[model samples]
Target: MPRPRTGRRVRTLLAAALTTLAPLVFLTGPAQAAPAAAGAWTPAPAPVVSHVETDDPVVFITIDDGWATEEAAGARQLLLERRIPASLFLLPDAYERDRDYYRTLLAHGPSRIENHTTTHPDLTTLTEAGQRAEICGARDRQLAAFGDGPRLLRPAGGATYNWPYHNADTRTAAPACGAEAIVMWTHDLTTWGSWTPPTPELKAGDIVLLHMGPTLEADLTRALEAADAAGLSPAPLRDYLLG
Candidate 1:
């Protein structure tokens, strides 16, 4: 042995070994983490659907907004009594005013409350962030109140046509806000004041649109009758949409 190794010499040798290994330690750390970092992904936008193509004898009923307390009672009664699984796309304020109304419908019937935004705004006109706020804000409120989150989003405002006002941003924001589909309609039967829009001959996989107001009860009745005439029954929209 060349002179018993001094403590200082031993320390120096150990330091050199450690320095040589340090680059590998740093490199391995990042290499191990790279997979996880690369796995991160953003969700794709939800699809807009005006109709579902199916051969089953089924129709989808969707009601929008939550206003018209007295007028809505008849509709509520019909829904509960008939056990129609209508998708209620409601505004936050509408249900907040009378949570019990929706709660009871959900408790007793096959109906479910879905999202129509906090304030009904033309989603096509809103910025991406603004549209997200409206869509996600409604989802949060509904989840808090009902212990259930809305899976479908119906963009607000459509006139003389079935599809609601929406844009590319609406589709992108909808999925980000937890909506699976941006629901449009094949038939809009909303009645305004004394004017009742004519009902179309119902068909399988048709999406029927109605509103909560003075004519809801009548509209619901007519829709059911039309569905019956077409040999279609009202089916749960969520199940059909997902399937």
Candidate 2:
């Protein structure tokens, strides 16, 4: 004979059914809000530019480090006289001794100060946080000294060897520090010691690298002459890069 359904049996069955359906109901019904992702989101890395690709008849002049300014008076005059829109990747310590020198360069011409890190350390050797401090710290100091923030970063070292030393961290750290591009050089025209590097035929989008040294004036002249030969005029790097 079949057993009749009892109240207890009914109650137990109902409870079991509720237990089985509860999870499904919970899952299908309006979902509970999830916790937000951890950590603040950072922006994508800025582009690394060794040279600009453009059709304009223009070249870029970049002078690294603010040291040797005393011997670079002629170079300074050339920058002002020609209104060259040179990107000055100056260190804080480099300009601390002669704020007026850089000040005059920025005040009179289209030249603008860019970041070269606070201590001029090879950024590839640093952690992301260390690189950020070096880059962002330099920016803060530059803003204080020049009354304008830097838009470009030229990482310390790499020019002499014609190879840029930057890792993934450098690209990320630069944007975090407000840099739009990691500017390297297409041609290093800087005069080291008694040796003057041969000036290649300047292309329309070539980036020339010079340093503030005893030969900066001569270096600038060589670069300008090369540009003239190639029918390229010096243009503002910042404008071109942003555009």
Candidate 3:
């Protein structure tokens, strides 16, 4: 029989529910969006933060899920050299394991680390209390580590069939946990596997997604170079969304 999932394993198994969704709401919307002002705390119209409709010339490079390694260490330097501004949504486990590693990225420059969650769970199936624990727990850890920035929750989600994945409870729990928005992605570079989507060219205000891994060095190098070739300047998600 298939192994009965438990705890974190259940999370891994349940996440498969989101495998068939193609989230491109913002980019598909109007070409012009009045940029938001600073200190805006409103959530995007969707429960997840896939992309935002903005009439700006800049694109955002957002990296999620930390798997610290020498490759990532080197990538941080490349980030500095290239002056790539990125938003990192870090899981508490990854952060705890590589606190100093990510701190180096934060210490170096404009890269900001937000919360992904405490235990990398699929929030859709969780109860209110469970969602709160994940969101609030991650926010607390991020604050303790990265100090302060945007309280955005980049819930541990990917897959397609699911849009936001986090149910109504997730919405209620996020603000309580200090998250302003539940950030998702518009385009993802599946660095861990061989299924990378064809990223033709990054458009203005597009949110490009990446994950930390052994392939990050090559993947980031390639992605940033593409951004440059496409004339899309990478910007911080905080400014692009909340202004």
Best TM-score among the predictions, by candidate number:
2
lDDT (CA) for every model shown?
0.77, 0.78, 0.66
lDDT of 3 by residue, 1-243 (tens): 222224234334323332334355422321122234354332222234566676676878888878765557777778777777788887777777878877777787788887777877778878767888887887777777778744667776534435456654565467667666667776776565766556557777677788887777777877777778888778887765552
Winning candidate number (lDDT): 2
Question: Could you tally the backbone clashes for each prediction?
Answer: 0, 0, 8
Query: How well does each candidate superpose onto the true structure, as a TM-score?
Result: 0.80, 0.82, 0.76
**What lDDT score goes with residue 11 in model 1?**
34
Poorest 10 consecutive residues by lDDT, candidate 2: 23-32
> Against the hidden true structure, what lDDT does model 2 obtain?
0.78
Name the regions of candidate 2 deviating beyond 4 angstroms. 1-39, 158-163
The per-residue C-alpha lDDT of model 2 at residue 133 equals 98
Tens-place lDDT digits, model 1, residues 71-168 = 68888998999899999999999988899899999999999999998888877677778999999999999999999999889889734333337665
Worst 10 residues of 3 by lDDT: 26-35
- By lDDT, highest first, what's the ranking? 2, 1, 3
Two-way TM-score contest, 1 vs 2, winner = 2
